[model samples]
Target: MAHCALEVADVFRSLGPGWHQSVNLSLGQLKVVSAIEQCRSAALGGHVLRCEGCAAIEVAYNSCRNRHCPKCQAAAARRWLEARQADLLPVEYYHVVFTLPAAISEIAYYNKAVIYGLLFDMAAETLRTIAADPKHLGAQIGATLVLHTWGSALTHHPHVHGIVPGGGLSPDRSRWVACRPGFFLPVRVLSRLFRRRFLEELEAVYHRGQLQFFGEHTELIDPGVFAKWLAPMRACEWVVYAKRPFAGPEAVLAYLSRYTHRVAISNQRLISLDERGVTFRWKDYRVDGRTRNKTMTLAANEFVRRFLLHVLPAGFHRIRHYGVLANPSRRENLSKIRALLHVALEAVDPDGDVSSCAAQPSFVCRHCGSPMIIIDMLQRSRPIRAPPPEQCHA
Candidate 1:
């Protein structure tokens, strides 16, 4: 989690309003910008804390807690991982990615809600379908599919990362079906099935008038034109690849801690902001080893626009669980799976003690190492004036 000296919020604070006006931003994108600008600032209000031992005081502002805010996702990710800790099984986990082709992605830019949902549904279906085939694992598997819509350079590259247990339950529910060592399902099979299912579903949605096309894609409104557009995608290879299995369940948690809450870009990638542009590092997958992580500079407004390209539709879920891990049957399925694996059930705190779940460190006195205690409620009306220059720790 290496962070650059400058934060995305700093960029927003300096140039957000003008950037917002330069583009016709969606409601969700506007909300994200507003949150980033106001996050942890005097605008949102905060509290004053006093060191229990040193008598030194500090001000801490409130977080916007918007999911898309880079400044706010770290804690959100940690809390989410804590809750998911109990869900881990004593089994191997596999990482699989299903990515849409560039053609489909272009259309997705205009039809995010429909296409993104299709991605989740088809990705989950592909895994479940293939795993259930007798020629494959022949088991009913579950997956945690997280939708990511941006590439390294913040381009619209829609993909779903699936965290699936290396094995699953027997068709009869009588045994734990395990995959071959170091392998889950074949990527080739997954690609074909995913592409076919996705295109079929996309066509269904189009026929129902559920997908909208604008700009260059406006001609796709015609059924014949749309069919011609999709014909090539049907033959082209879809991108589906599986990474090596995670070391173990703990490794899975570590991976989830990073990916689960990530926004389009983290503040860590931002190197510097200047009159010329904002420079940030991005991995160039097209390049060979040693030069992949390259810096990219975009005009401030352009950077903001590319970042906003990923703002999701309102109430859209980017993270989802399917099959056994799905909400309705998760508890029961996990209980049965744990029993089959002979793992003990995690002890549940019936009274739900809130403190036990809080994993973050208590803010401490930098000089004396004693915990800080809230001393005063700071109202928004109180402008966040500078802390006494001699006393402030920043």
Candidate 2:
């Protein structure tokens, strides 16, 4: 299995000098670069694991456990789903995506931690409020929202993916009100309400001096400039795409694995990362049914720049809950939802087969030629580590 870091390294080495030395480098991005370099498998602990296909033995190291680290996304993904298991309702769920326009991407990059936060809150609130309307489901809806910051080409495209139950409890909390079998809320109405609530909140944030613009957007500090800039977005059709409601709990889990804890890109998509720049596969949305995993090469510096664009703010969480999933009432709400739907309550790892889940491949130590079991798992208690160039031996 080729790791994203290794592929990054192949690109990282080819960049001209002063790649990481530029003054424009944000403090947030510098941390990601440092974290990724220190994540070489040799440092964390594997020795050498031989491949069955050939006599090849690779050295492996443990991941840095950072959310942004591609290697660590899987572990975090599993843990997130485990916690969310307690929040799953018995009814079918829907996957709703809310996309911001390109005009907003620059502002979003400047205030990612704030505007994105507002985006999630306002969007979730809008869905719940509208669904509770008598004309709609007329009940409280529960949802799980996760933020995605990168597009297929690694550009800054901030969007929110919502995993929402199709229906919810009425005001009386006495009975279940299932939504239309194939639908949840009207996308047309959700778009309008979402647009209004989001813009209203954005204006409040701007007025309180919470927003800032830099780089090419420095002039946006003026009030009139921002108002005019925002005007075009209102008429620009705020994108809201709703997929078919999920079939059942099993399908929900499958969807969670794909959406939750997903990094900008995955290792499986990478084909080669040698001297010919960097090459990887991606599903192009414009091409329709035709699928291609073609590899494209890019200069190392440009590649790293693109990858680093997605490094989130420190301590910022991408996944959040609303309504029934909120921490204060999640457990009780889950029980009630289960009762109303007459479905048996289930656990995250219902079968207690977590360990039996697929195990990652480990490298055998070069000296001992034995499978190197992890002797110590590094935690927050461990001292901070500097960058490691070559493989750090176990």
Residue 91 in model 1: lDDT = 87
Q: Which of the numbered candidates is closest to the native, going by highest lDDT?
A: 1
Predict model 2's lDDT versus the native.
0.73
Residue-level lDDT tens digits of model 1 in 1-394:
2334888777776684455554566656666777777778788888898988989988888888888889888888877777777778888899999999998999898889999999999999999999999999999999999999999999889999889998999999888999999999999999999999999999999999999888899999999999999899888998899999999888999999889989999888998999988899999888654548799999887888898888888899989999889988887898889999999966655332234666545577777888888888767643322223333221
Worst 10 residues of 1 by lDDT: 385-394
Candidate 2 regions exceeding 4 Å error are 1-6, 13-18, 45-60, 274-276, 287-295, 347-394
Write the residue-wise lDDT of candidate 2 on 60-149 in tens digits. 555677777676777778766665555666677899999878877778887988888887898789888998899988998788899999
- Residue 279 accuracy (lDDT) in model 2: 71
Each prediction's total of clashing residue pairs, residues at least 3 apart in sequence or on different chains, is 0, 9
TM-score of 1: 0.91
Q: Cα RMSD for candidate 2?
A: 5.9
Task: Judge candidate 2 at residue 200 and give its lDDT.
Answer: 86
lDDT of 2 at 59: 49
Residue pairs whose backbone atoms clash in candidate 2 = 41-61, 42-392, 47-364, 47-365, 48-363, 48-364, 48-365, 49-363, 49-364
TM-score of 2: 0.83
lDDT comparing candidate 1 with the true structure: 0.85
